[model samples]
Target: MSNKKPILAITMGDPAGIGPEIAVKAFSDSAVYNLCRPLLIGSAAIMSRIVKELNSRLKVNSINNVTEAGFQFGEIDVFNLEIHNPEDIKYGQISSTAGDIAFRSVVKAIELAKNGEVDGTVTNPINKKAINNAGHHFSGHTEIYAHYTNTPKYAMLLADEKLKVIHVSTHVSLRKACDLVQKERILDVVQILNEGLKKLGINSPRIGVAGLNPHAGDEGLFGDEEIKEIIPAVKEANERGFIVEGPIPPDTLYALAAGGKFDGCVAMYHDQGHIPFKLMGFVWDDDIGKMKSVKGVNITLGLPIIRTSVDHGTAFEIAGKGIASPEALLYAINYAVKLYNN
Candidate 1:
């Protein structure tokens, strides 16, 4: 393996969303250059337009391959995909063309990582509706990554600072999500979380599993998922020599995890995991009527290749306004580097 700095392939998400804006802004930061060689895999025309729209002074160099990238300070190297028309790039509008481009960028990034052209990938937020409109038929980034890479046992891990969470099920309806929770799935997620935490430098990480029902089914009064599925999984994990806890109450597990009681928490479904993670990472300013800061990194575990992404989505309304926060992407990039190093 190469001992040099890890090369990260950043995919520019939906052209109509904040993906392009943030990509331009992220490379403008001098600190990003210091960590690793960042190469953008997206439309060069759209990126150039964003740089101009944002009034950024940084220069963007279009390259055909990773070796051709300059990786120099004050310069952004973009591998031109040429998938979008400069005139067709409209903010806050969804089009099949834009969706196809976004899907292609992700596919290319996975291909690069699988081929060892890059160490890992950090993806911008993609619009699910748009991607589906383009006939790609992916539910989200995790699904797409899993499909293209043929990874069968993948899970989504959300990280911000010390708090890390892995989900048992995501992108499914509430009814289906509840039914999908089982001992096998829960155990798989726990194992993935334990392995991931270790890679993040946590030795013998403590994992807390959240119950699927309200108030942990009140000990079978509210639901039996905790007793039937969650508890069994936790017991199995503990028997395997993992420091695992729970079938804990969902309401309080997040608080305990946030309080640093555990290294990571295993959530039952999408909202159960996303709500608490976002609440901690997203800071809303009521006076400004907007988010003050958006944080967190979404990592897809069990893939053949390493993939991390901004924990938020495409903010189409702020696509060209130059106000998009690149903090999440920065965090994702940093985490991707750490994962690569490990």
Candidate 2:
């Protein structure tokens, strides 16, 4: 009742996916309501259907604006865009209607954050092909936020219980990702990660920079990227008084980082970071054919507005099964709240 907590605008990702269901599940947790005021930015009709389908005790309060949100548990305040009729969406299938609604919800959340109407934004997963089919051509959530916020320098920071990894180049081809590894870009990501760690309550972060090649280029035998680009970047970061160490072999760096060796890590590409992080955080239940716990928060660093998202993609295979874990979304919302408070 203090009215001091941040108000978060939670976007409904691809309507055909588990976005709506997870939003419902995440809000059902009373902890989320106690920490921050949540405003769901998507179709009220879709959420209403999802609530009924899930047989949840919660109800949806369709509001026209942020000011109308009640911020109450058992009643979700939706900033209804009304972009899709629940009848138009088919579970486990991608359609242009779902894509359009997903895109619109994200754009609206960004606008609210930029205008100071909300403290931060929490996004669920959106299918890339679906959004492209709807004519909004963007690779993923990070790219969309970067373009809309006009943020030139941004890195995707993925964090779970102990491991944290930031990417230098994401949503690009392997060839292009290699070409993107430069000293300046590496340094930039390290700087962003350092600042991000401080926000996460690390007083002094020891950062690790991963090498692009195996065995850190075998001392320039396998490749010279470490000596040419990575070493210089690490040297500069160290000289700048950042507790940084790097040019470590990617094969072993993540293992050490996960064991509490480093505060965070910087990777050369998307999969380099994601593969290891997901391996650690994601748990699949083969018997149920769904995730038991999707446990990572994808935070966009260097953005003017705070934005965090579920690290996992839209689980289209089990969209309406009522079993898609909302753990990742809960983590994302909590992270957004943490960053906003920071």
Candidate 3:
């Protein structure tokens, strides 16, 4: 029993997506094993196909239990879910079968983490439509984590080297997103963000809250959300001893945070935070018409078990191309280890 390495369960998101590819690429990097013992929880057949497709030299050691895994440095350890065949594993396609398999893998990972079978679970990307098509009815990973862990309060934290963002409402429409920003919800998210940063080793995290409307409603000209809900939330959070500042203009807050002025920012909606985070983390090469680097980790805070995932999605178009970037998955696994250590 090597106590130096934390046991991490990595789930292959959807066979139809780039999940298998990135999971293989992430573990193939020898540096990953140095931080934690990673055990992939997905189908062996799918992984085998991916290994051959990518021409990766690493071998897959299939196991039924976490303890059964070899945890070898160069070899990839997979807990075979045995859900799909190679013939059924078509890339860039959406099917209920794939959805069911992806959902089940996540469920199994959650069960293992809750039971302490693994220290944490880091997930690859999964399409919400696919998961819903399989009758799982999940909006995204955060909701799945919340349901399985029975956690009432949780926030989606997107992190990179320069900036960290926690969203108040995600996977909701822009109109509904604004409506959901009440004082209580704002305060709850703020508290979660503060606590999450502390766990990430920040002793005193300086948090900036983004406004809900354009120019923060221009002092009630654009919208009243900032004045009514956002400001009150910041005020209440401060009263509770949280080092919080906000209702700042959404467009400007992210830039300030990315510039290292603030430790993290609370985004009002999905795109408000996602765009800025991706702008900083994802690099594209226009001449090559491809992404040079895709970095960032999506962490669901307030769950009973630690859950981190790639901030990107299931790129069905490039699923089996062996070109998908594993940087995000690698970062997510590393972030999970950091959280576990903290």
Candidate 4:
């Protein structure tokens, strides 16, 4: 392991959304500089604009390449992709211009990571619709990373201080996610989740696999996915010398995982994992009409290179407001450092 600080290439997500603002906001924290040699992969003009908007002390230093980066505090070292006029991207609006910029940033980051120019990659939120509109038809960061890196099998790992959850199937509808509940898929995710947990410092992970049906199919009374698919996966996992349990009821499993009954969990689908993890991390103040704090890290497991991202989305509602919370991005940066170190 290298004693020197890890170099992290962070993609500023969507210019039309809160990506630029949040990226600048995160840079204001000096702790991130201590953790890694952070380089922002986005337009320096946009970032500079956000810095001015926030009236932050940090300045943006535009660099044509990573080698020219200063990696200094009190300034953002941006691998400036001057592809579009930053003024053209209207906040809170979906446009191909914004999408193209965001897509380019991600592609650039992946290139740098694959070439070993950076130790890992951290991402801000990107709008799926916006990216697709720009002619980039990728679903999300996980898919984008998998495709660009040539990784076939990967799982979305949502983590916080309390519970850690990995999805067996994400970015799919309820119907399709159900159809995906097969012995092979579940076992694959379990292995991914198990390895991810150990890498995150849980050597002996107690994985709780959630059932597909209510009451865990009520012992085949409700649905047979538990009996037919999930059970066999669990049996195979245990037989393979894993500390596995479940086909446990979704509701019961989450509550147990939340209270620390398990080190991590393998969720059946996206919402089954995201809902609980977000509930724990995203705190909203109803009276204030804003989030008090947004916290959670999204890690893409089974990738060739490390990729960690903020667990939230591009809050188009609050884009350019300078009010977007940096808590999640900070957590993500920390996780990126941890993953790189490990």
lDDT of 2 by residue, 166-283 (tens): 9999999999998899999999999999999998888899999999998989999998989999999999999998988989999999999999999999999999999999999988
Q: On a 0 to 100 scale, what is the lDDT of residue 105 in model 1? A: 92
Model 2: how far residue 338 lies from native, Å: 1.3
Query: 2 or 4: which has the higher lDDT?
Result: 2
CA shift of 192, model 3, Å: 0.4
Residue 215 C-alpha lDDT in model 1: 87
- How far residue 188's Cα lies from its native spot in candidate 4, in Å, is 0.7
Q: Please give the clash total of every predicted structure, in order.
A: 0, 0, 0, 0
Please report, in order, the local distance difference test score of every candidate based on alpha carbons.
0.90, 0.92, 0.88, 0.90
User: How much is 2 displaced in model 2, in angstroms?
Assistant: 11
lDDT of residue 92 for candidate 1: 90
Pairs that collide, model 4: none
For residues 1-342, write the lDDT of model 3, one tens digit per residue.
234678999998988999988888888888898898899988887788789888888798888888889888768888888674447657899887788889888999999999999999999878788889889998988898899999999999999889999998999998898789899998998889988998898989999999988888899999788988999999999999998888899889988988888898999889998998998888999997778999999999988888899988898888878788888898998899889888
Candidate 3 clashes between residue pairs 3 or more apart in a chain or in different chains: none
C-alpha lDDT (0 to 100) for residue 57 of candidate 3:
85
> What TM-score do all the candidates reach, one by one?
0.97, 0.97, 0.97, 0.98
Q: After superposition, how far is residue 25 of candidate 4 from its true place, in Å?
A: 1.5
Cα RMSD (angstroms) for every candidate in the order listed: 1.3, 1.6, 1.7, 1.0
Task: Give candidate 4 misplaced runs (Cα > 4 Å).
Answer: none
Report how far residue 63 has shifted in candidate 2, in Å: 1.1
